[model samples]
Target: MHMVELKGVSKAFGDVDAVSNVDLTIREGEFVTLLGPSGSGKTTLLNLIAGMATPSAGRIEIRGRDVTHSSASERDLGMVFQNYALMPHMSVFENIAFPLRVRRLSRQEIERKVNDVLDLVQLPQIKDRKPRELSGGQQQRVALARCIVYNPALILLDEPLGALDKKLREYMQLEIRRVHAELGITMLNVTHDQDEALTMSDRIVLMNQGRIEQQDTPEQLYFRPKSVFAADFIGTANLVECEVSAVNGDRVRVTGAAGAFEVTEVEADVAVGDRVTSVIRPENVEVRAAGDDRESTGSDNPWIEAVVKDSLIVGGVVRHYLTIAGDVPVVAQQANSRSRLLLSHGDRVSLRWAQNDCRIIAC
Candidate 1:
């Protein structure tokens, strides 16, 4: 069953359209993320789903019930914001009990429910502490506990970890996923951080300029992006403009500013003489000393002579930035190993990658 469905949904403010003719369906208990850059209409679409903002057209249904015009309170959604919206004066216990109290739940019922959530969030010992006494991560946990205390059918998270530091943010991503697993509630998260979306989402809905650029599982979106925007935005990629020189079955040869290269797994309707962009992730390209014999490296792999412009060691990964064909730029990421030869600045090297690692997208 679909927990949420939006059909031809649109939201406009005067001449500006924040969300434009979007159709999306979220399955029950699915963890979906809305990922995009700022002003991409992700937040506006979340608001429409929460019923905080009314859509200009189309329909929204939650579990077969029309809620397009429902008030925020009527949507039965649990919302968590980046600010950790806990009452500063309230103890952890009181903050979690607020939702239940609003509904006039019996005191005994509220106590049992809040205690269960506290244990689920692994903060049973902090019930007596006030929000001001807790750490950022702890306070965020309290906010989350409060949201889930009533077991709302849908949870909306709007940059819920944005206020935390990088290390805390990383830790909380796992925590959120754990909670989602335990509760089995439908969750829709909004964030512009690609890594966060990649780590936490079962499926990522990438938005751009009030439209969905693509929606796919994280692995598919990263490994086989359907568009240039998706390829560039999801992760670091070397996008090379090329003209299709030849096509043979699933394999195609393309010549770019960096030189000739062959790419396999051609899924697009590509033909000879067509302009296309070949995308290869930095980690997929291997760097070897320029003097290496062609036969030593697989002959079928594409190799281009490049001069290393700079090299940086980041967390045991050596990133070599090279200039191919004099001006065309490419980056190769190699794991630091005992057998690896460290390439220094101005060193001439060969960049090689398997044809299957490269994706050809229409220009």
Candidate 2:
């Protein structure tokens, strides 16, 4: 079933358009992320779904019920925010129990539900501690527990891990995923952090300038980006803008600042002398040094000459910045294996990738 659906949703703030016409659907029990850069309307869209803001136009349905005109309390939703929104004087148990108390549930039932969620969050031992007494992660866990205690139809997460340190944030990502899996609850998350979105989402709705730029699985958004923004936004993408020189069935030869190159993938109806951008992931390119006999760069092989402008070690990978064909920049990432030859600046290299590895976008 469609847990949450938006049809032609648009929100405007006077002269500014926070969210333009958008159509989206979140499946039952699915984790969907509204991923984008800052000021891209991800938060606004989330606010619209949360009923924190009214939409200028469109329809919203939750679990097949129209909720466009409903208030936040009328819609069954649990919200976890960046600030952790816990009452200072309230104990963990009280915090989780407060929602049930508002609903006028039985005292016995609130106790049962609060204990259950604390156990679910693996913090049953901290029920008596106040919000200030718990650590940041613990406090966030309390926020999540309070959210899930009522068994709301959907949970909304707005940068829930943003306040934690890097290590704690990473740990919380896994913890949240664990909680989601155990409860089988649908989650809608808003985040500008691409890694967070890519790591946690079942599907990503990438927003750009108040519009839905692309929506797809994380892998597809990274590897098969349909636009330059999607390619550059996800990860380390080496986009080579080339002018189409020739087309041979599925193969197309394009000349860019990096000179002429042939890729066996091209958009249909692409004619000669038209400009097209091709996306190649940095990790997908094989960086063989100019004189490396281990990999032959013969005429039949697909290879391009590049001069390494910079090289650095980033954890387990070595990133090399290369200047190809009149200063066109391309990045190549290689695993930091013991036997791997590490190149220095000014080292000439051959960058090669499979024809299928090149994603040619018409736009």
lDDT of 1 by residue, 1-363 (tens): 799999999999999999999999999999999999999999899999999999999999999899999999998899999998799888999999999999999999999999999999999999999999999999999999999999899999999999999999999999999999988999999999999999999999999999999999999999999999999999999988999999988889998786887889564899899999889999998777866775534536666788999988888888889988859789888887777767788899887778888999998
Residue pairs that clash (backbone atoms under 3 angstroms), model 1: none
Model 1 CA RMSD to the hidden true structure, in angstroms: 1.3
lDDT of 2 by residue, 258-306 (tens): 6676787554468998888988888888888766756534423357889
Residue 79, candidate 1: Cα error in Å is 0.3
Candidate achieving the largest lDDT = 1
Against the unseen true structure, what C-alpha lDDT does each candidate score?
Answer: 0.92, 0.89
Per TM-score, the best of the predicted structures is: 1
- CA deviation > 4 Å runs, candidate 1: 294-299
Give the local distance difference test score of model 2.
0.89
Measured against the true structure, the TM-scores of the candidates, in listed sequence, are: 0.97, 0.96
lDDT accuracy of residue 84 in candidate 2? 97
Report the error of model 2 at residue 194, Å.
1.0
